[model samples]
Target: MNELKDKVALITGGTKGIGLGIAQALLSQGIHVAITSRSAKAAEETAKQLNSSATKARAIGVKADVRDFESQQNAVRLVLSEFKQLDFVIANAGLGHFASIEELTLEQWQDTIDTNLTGAFYTIKASVEALKKSKGYYISISSLAGANFFAKGAAYNASKFGLTGFTQAVMLDLRQHGVKVSTIMPGSVSTHFNGNEPDSSDDWKIQIEDIGELVVDLLKMNPRALPSKVEVRPTMPPSK
Candidate 1:
């Protein structure tokens, strides 16, 4: 882990929940982190929290709409300006709008794809050059929905499934350049995703911190070993 100290990472949609969780874990490893949110204020607030005196690592906040190529490019530039070299880029920004195919509006479906799928594309395109120079890692926070579709999850499922395939294709393209790419698909995480509050009863679900720890482990893995896709689930959960 000490080998990773002073490295840098940029996380998209990093203000709250899983993104923030990953930021915290990276900071703990002495990695400089730049976390982005659509809101400048929220991004700055969380960056400050992560860089508190106790942990006291370099952290920056940037406002970027991953849905836009220009915005994502600006974010990549900001991270380069702050940290010089980027060792990891996490395409963790996402959204979910659940509705049956007939019930889903065109706008809702478009927003989900734009945010959850195209956003990852924009982010990777913006960062790939820098990642190549650093021989870094690219990890996308895909979800179980990427593989399992539900009755009311047409928009969300389609976006994630596309994202899953997109990341895999990217992995094959970037690996020759010494950059590693992977996607993490998590199930039933105790997070604020989809605006759902996590209560005590949600403890049986995977914790956001658990995902963070998994990311750290991935980063620490031997460079020759790559777990290109990971599906995480709670060890014990209420039966279906």
Candidate 2:
């Protein structure tokens, strides 16, 4: 586990929600991190605050549009520039666009698929080489929706389901190279996802820090062990 410390990580959409939670958890473990967002200011501000914490783990905020391969590649470049090594990459930048097939717009469908699915591919393509060099870990924050279907969730379901399959397949392709890959699918996380602000009323939802701890634990697993896919749900949700 001592080897886990002092590693460098790059997380997409790390300015808030699950990404930020994961960053804090890793930083406390002495890992340097670079988090990206669509908004430059938000990313910079959040990075500044994290750096100010006594953890003393360096943090950098980068502006990136995960939907674009070049943007993701640039983020990778920035992370290497800062930390000189890449150890962990989290493809967490995702957005949901839910609507019935009849109501979903072309733009909405494209945006959802591009950001959640193809974006993950771009991240992996850009970082896999660096990760291979360090025998690093690649984790994607997926959703239970990848397996469960609901009405008016065509786009979101497609993206997550694709993500689950994509990450798993890549896991097989990369394991021999010594890079561990995993996907975390949470039932419902209390975060500012889909524009819903988390409140005390959201106690029933899975907390972001729980997901963060899960990531750290995965990193600490024995070299011979690989839990490629994880399913996490709230112990209890409001009784319905």
Candidate 3:
């Protein structure tokens, strides 16, 4: 879209899956995109794969662990150094752990919460000033698990639920500053998230590209309108 042309966008955990999809979508629209991964190799590889002369410029990828505040901050800095401005930040890096409450270890709970919730906070806090300067957007890739509880998902559910609340409050707090914030909660995406293998057989699951398309739509929307929350699901999930 014309609105996204020349804008700079950053996506965390964007080496593959949903994050990569979003990066690709933005790049196709002429947006300058930056992506972060835990590994420098993965980041470089993904950027190479997404780059094309047609996209105007290749996406930039940086090594960043979202759980580390300094790392998150550095990722934003790298983007700014390369692009000269940061217009959007997508806090899409997250993890999930599934276990019944009685069986869940404290370590497992902490890992989930730290990566999924606290990591998002770190990424946003690092980018807040840049976003405010550009009057940009902050999008969180949450999950339906944030609202719907399930067996063996106590830790994952808690992290997501807390994230949902956090996203809403941040949206309200940032709106006054002309920075838009929104959360996208998707269910059962066909991606390698949380170590799940994605195969062609998993056609019933939500496609990663769909989430990418949604983010592009959000960027194209008028500044007067803000869809602070969006919940998406596969129209026809396979029957058990």
Candidate 4:
């Protein structure tokens, strides 16, 4: 925690869900954070909520659309201007568009691929230089669908699969620069993903804070080691 104090982290799609969870955890560790959302209102409101609970670190909000390369670039610039350094980049902005090939529309497919795959590329491209300078970490929130495909998940699966592979290749490319990169593939996380509301029924699913803790653990690991890729799921989900 002491080692992480005063460091800066940027989380995309951070108004809620896994990104917001990670932001909270980082701030609790005395790491300042900037959270981005497509809605300026959401970003600022979430940042205020984070600041209220912050102990030793501060929180700021930026409006950015990860699907746009220029938007991502501007976001990184804003963070750099405010924090003076970027120590961590969490590319957590992603969306799912699930449907069978026969039912999926071209718009749905494009949105999924653009937001989940190309968005991650834009995020890393925009922040890689800053990360290289700081020897920072880059983490992406992927999904188990990346590794295992299923019916009605064509668009979602393709996007996540691309994200997983992209993050791994990025890991190989950035390690020599001392910038760590990894992807977290989670299964059935209790978030408002795909319009499912979370409730007590979600108790058996992986929680956002759990992912946050995993990220913190990764950050605390010795520089000699890297987890590179992590696949996390509920230990005891109801039998299929």
Across 141-178, the per-residue lDDT of candidate 1 in tens digits comes to 99999999889998999999999999999999999999
Please give, for residues 30-104, the per-residue lDDT of candidate 3 as tens digits.
Answer: 888888999999999888888854346568879999889999989998899999999999999988778788889
Clashing pairs in 2: none
lDDT of each: 0.92, 0.93, 0.90, 0.94
In lDDT terms, which candidate is top? 4
Return the TM-score for candidate 3, rounded to 2 decimals.
0.96
Please rank every candidate by TM-score, starting with the best.
4, 2, 1, 3
Worst 10 residues of 2 by lDDT: 1-10
Model 3: how far is 107 from its true place, Å? 1.7
Predicted structure 1: lDDT: 0.92
* Per-prediction backbone clash count: 0, 0, 0, 0
Off by over 4 Å in 1: 53-56
RMSD of each: 1.2, 0.9, 1.3, 1.0
Which lDDT tens digits does candidate 4 get at residues 1-240? 228999999999999999988999999989999999999999999999999989899999999999999999999999999999999999999998777899999999999999999999999999999999999999999999999999999999999999999999999999999998999999989999889899999999999899999999988888878899999999999987
TM-score of each: 0.97, 0.98, 0.96, 0.98
lDDT of 2 by residue, 89-160 (tens): 999999999889999999999999999999999999999999999999999989999999899999999999
